[model samples]
Target: MAGRVAAVDCGTNSIRLLIADLVDGRLVEVDRRMTIVRLGQGVDASGAFAPEALERVFAAASDFAAVIRAAGVGRMRFVATSAARDVSNREVFRNGIEERVGIRPEIISGEEEAELSFRGATTSLDLPAPYLVTDIGGGSTELVLGDAGGVIAAESLDIGSVRLTERHVTTDPTSAVELAAITRDIDVLLDKTRVPLDEARAVVAVAGTATTVAAVALNLPEYDRDAVHRARLTADQLRDTTTWLTTSTRAARAAVHSIHPGRVDVIGAGALILQRLVDRLSVDSVLVSEHDILDGVALSLG
Candidate 1:
């Protein structure tokens, strides 16, 4: 079956939209875009969406609405994660989107977010199982283990790039003290994943953090989805990248042709999370996938 659909993923740090055409069971991207709104800027401590965050998200929604309309999408779905889930004033966030886009955003559970990420990252690859899919977002991280039959186990951790950076890193070129604190927080959550990490034959990492890290590891002149997708980043590469990110100034990270301006401040924490996961899992390499929950959200529309 073939159809046209639009999918929107609103996370703590960014709002992304994917409009694609499903042709003979394959997804062809029509217009995939992202805007950093830092929706979860202070949600970790406040437990509410900041007024600025809400306005930024709504503005992006307004822009996405136009893109979605122009594409003539047959169906559309919006999935909000992490920051949206913990916020106390969700009604305001909900009403804003509903009014701007004419469609309400569904704040998905961590379990659901994990499943969708697994489905999207592994569907197009002929990788061995059980593949551990990791999606490091701004406010949380999702770990999903699955085989060809489908998801077998999934867990979401409360640690994320934005959350940890905001909580721990208070200075430019984060100090060792801050990095250590972030590491402790991540390690605690990683230990909580009762699923046997050793069972997975290979690992696949998805989302902005992973892709950005991959782009830097490859030393690409710029960010390219085709190059980053299915890219295998070795343990050494992860370690090296993490070191550079942790030790570099914010300007240095932002100067990287591959690093997005919005991710400059928090990418160091994100790299730490990925490196720790790689070290914890004892995997030789992690395969990066560009298709993640956003793609999975679009597929669900069919």
Candidate 2:
């Protein structure tokens, strides 16, 4: 059997929509898009979704509704992570989305998010056993370890781009004091995560942060998903990129060809998180994967 399906992933920094045709168990991509709505803005400080943040996400959801309807998707799954899970006024956020998209968003747990991310990211790669998939988002980072059998261990930490930026970054490129604070926060979370970082044979970095880092590491003129997918980013490459990002001004970072304008403010923190993971794991490089939780959500529809 075959069907058209849509998967929506709403995170703190952005909201993405993926529409695909599942033909006899294979997924064929039809449409993929993302909007930077900053939905998690102020959530870390306020413990609730800000009114403007809610509006931005609602607007994005409305646009996704149009895309879904036009694509004639038979089934759709909408998920909200990190920020949605922490907000106290989540019902308000849910109502707006349900009214616009006609589907109530599931605020999934960190463990479930890790599993979905693992399935979406690693199923097609011919990598070694016991792959470590790290998805760094705006509000949290998911670390999942698994092989062909399934997920072995998973953990989600509060260290993320947007959260880190809000918590520690105040200067344009992030002062040394800010960077050190962010590093401490990440180290604490890493210590709490149960997975053995040194044991994994390979690391697969997914989501916007990793992809963007790859695009820069490759020195691509612009964002290219095909080129970045499965691209190897060496420890030196990551360290160099982190140094460039952390020392660059906001305007300078935004000027980078592949750096998204929305991400410029928080990418310094994001890069640091990724860099620390690489150093802690002692891996030579990380293989970037564009397919992540969105793909996993689509597969779950079947």
Candidate 3:
């Protein structure tokens, strides 16, 4: 654990960390953990971090600070994305985190976010042709089209499950009216963004949303990347899974044999986002990645 550099991703929905020691050509993971902090709950409406959201982030970061210290990790690279970069109160949150977590979270631009996600996604796969990379986070989703060497086109969408669920879908089952509005918005983005799916040989999805869905497909009791990563999922199966998830309450979803307890509440929105992407692109199957932006950050820093 000596000379380990820790990379922390303070995302709108989750705070993730990767402790690694570079070994020749590969990155070896020493420790990793994700905490659901929902830091962007109403930032889209209020144009600032909500009071409760700020509190959740501070409380969680304090704990992460302790873990980092316990692991004997000294050098750290921390970045915040989406909601943090969008809202004006980023400094306020950043000040609090530096005071409590002993680290000032750097706000990474959308381009950097897409790059890290792409780095994590493509490096984990063996792509035959260029692919469209999709990452669904809590506050934002990134859609990137790229080749083997670098990114070609990438855009970050403000539409995330947490934001969508808070703004539109209120009912336990998420009524059809709300669902329609969200779908219309997403469909329009897909059309307007002009992402070329016809040329893409495949689609790859990274981050918690895609990996969690893959886990459910494989019926894993715990989230295991070895089983979940690169798990092939179809558009039909994606739709079917989302339909099944929407029927249950948060408690019921958590009670399901496959779903993670911390992921149950927000997963409905994640599934919807994934399903829409799959449908719009006419994607028959997609590759899932357990590693995401955090892993890419570690790689980049090396």
Clashing pairs in 1: none
The TM-score that candidate 2 achieves is: 0.98
What C-alpha lDDT do the candidate models reach, one value each? Answer: 0.92, 0.92, 0.80
Quality of model 1 by C-alpha lDDT:
0.92
The TM-scores of all predictions, comma-separated, are: 0.98, 0.98, 0.93
Using TM-score as the measure, name the better of candidate 2 and candidate 3.
2
Candidate 3 least-lDDT 10 residues: 190-199
RMSD of 2: 0.9
Give lDDT for model 2: 0.92
Point out the worst 10-residue segment of candidate 2 by lDDT: 167-176
